[model samples]
Target: MTLTFAEAGEQDIPDLTRVMTRAFDDESRTYRGLDKGGPEGYDNGDFFRQWMLGYDETTGYTILLDGEVVGGLIVWIIPGGHNHLGAIFVDPAVQDRGIGTQAWQFVERTYPGAKSWRLETPAWSLKNHAFYERKCGFTKIDETDSPDGVMFVYRKIIHPD
Candidate 1:
């Protein structure tokens, strides 16, 4: 699938909410070992509200497949030319088609000056672990235990010459 990204705006909130909800529901269900509501007992609306409340348009992008919004990501370009992948999600229906990998490629090209990229994911999700390590060239840097669950931090150092 052809993938592109557009800057996320207030107008995209509803679509982003749906996409995020659909994309993460399975993980959320598997995460808590039951269909509680979301990854951490919160529903889609909770996630949407948090995103809307804390969103930064300058660092948010809606992932589009052939011009249709399919996913979204948030990245923070921090000081010292480093960056963080605040979040990235692809519609579960269209996953395993290399869209996430391509999205990361797009991000790398878009932020050519970035010296490194970092993100965190649920430690129980081995699929995510492999994707970040194998496909995205990230390394497991650390792990943290939180009230929600264990999270593994992944980091990829960019070598741009």
Candidate 2:
């Protein structure tokens, strides 16, 4: 399938909400300790969008597969040469298919001036840990437990020449 990154806009909220909510369904269930259903859920795009508004240097993109939205991401460019990966999610139905990897590569190339990359993920997400550490070349620098769950902070330094 052809994968592409499309700039996300305000009108894309419903689609983003649908894709990301489904994308994070498994993680939400795991975090909430619910096998069937629960109150607290994941992929609250409205909440995420509100949070992103606090960042001055953020960009959002929708992951499109064959012209269909399958996932989305938000990135913040730090002034001093660092790039923070605010969020990245692929539809759970389409996970493990390398769509996220390609999308990330596109982001990296799109922001070539970034000297480092930083992001955080839930400690409970073993698959995410593996993907970030192995496939994405990030190192888990630290992890801290919160009321919700443990958050793992990862970092990757881009080679400087």
Candidate 3:
């Protein structure tokens, strides 16, 4: 399966937001019995536009499989190669196809300067916990409470040869 990560444009916001909502809502229903869940402003794409694409040190992209848009990703590059994965998600309709793993490999290749990476998933997202810890090779470092929910912090340190 081929994958592409194109830098997001203003026009992509609406669809990306839809993908985000769908991905999050799926997990919420499975894990929490709720119909809605995600980072703030995802309901209307405001978070994607204002923070994911607009903030300093942040870069957002649209994940394309073959030629169709499937998801979105955001990254933050800070000084000292201490980077952060702001978010990454594939549409629920096409999930479990290894797209997320492929996208993560693409992310690592894209950010060759990164010496470490960090991200957070909601405490209740068991699938996310496994994906990050088992598939992505990140270790749970801590947990913190946010307005959205309790979040588990995960980190991976890249060792150079």
Candidate 4:
């Protein structure tokens, strides 16, 4: 399918929430396993909506597939450093179809002068780590954890020359 990347506006919040709910629901199932009976604590549509809408407008992009809202990435440009790719998710049904990769490449091409791109994923998500490293060209830089949880941070330097 032909996917398009566009600047997301406040009006797109609802559709974005729906897509995220569906995507994260699949992830919750993957991590929690089927024996949980029904969806556990991870299905937080309200939280996703709040987070997505809370993003600063100047640094985010939403993805549309075949003119339907599908996914997005919230990029934050740190004041004195690299760009941070805060979130990127596609509909679970569309995963492994290169939509995420294309969306990422679109971000890079759109912002040609960025010094580097950074992102963090849960340490437990091995599939995500492999995808970011092998497909998106990111390398694990460091990791951190607290009583809260652990996350692996990855970075890819983008040279303008």
Best by TM-score: 3
Best by lDDT: 3
In model 3, the runs with Cα more than 4 Å from the true position are: none
Task: Please state the error at residue 32 of candidate 3 in Å.
Answer: 0.8
Candidate 4 shows a clash count of: 0
lDDT at 28 for candidate 3? 91
Per-prediction TM-score, please?
Answer: 0.85, 0.88, 0.95, 0.82
lDDT head-to-head 1 vs 2, winner = 2
11-58 per-residue lDDT for model 3 (tens digits): 889989889999998999999999887777988988887778677899
lDDT of 2 by residue, 57-102 (tens): 8878889889889988889998888889988888888889998889
Candidate 4 lDDT score at position 136? 90
lDDT string, candidate 1, 32-51, tens digits: 56553344413444554455
lDDT of 4 by residue, 1-161 (tens): 77998877667667776777777667657875632211122244444344445555335567988998889777776654577887888888788889988988898888777888888877766777878999899999999884435779999998732
Candidate 2 stretches greater than 4 Å from native: 30-44
Error of 4 at 130 (Å): 1.5
Q: List the residue pairs that clash in candidate 2.
A: none
User: Each model's C-alpha lDDT?
Assistant: 0.78, 0.78, 0.89, 0.73
Q: Of the pair 1 and 4, which is ahead by TM-score?
A: 1
Model 4 misplaced regions, further than 4 Å:
34-58, 146-148
Worst 10 residues of 3 by lDDT: 47-56
Stronger candidate by lDDT (2 vs 4): 2
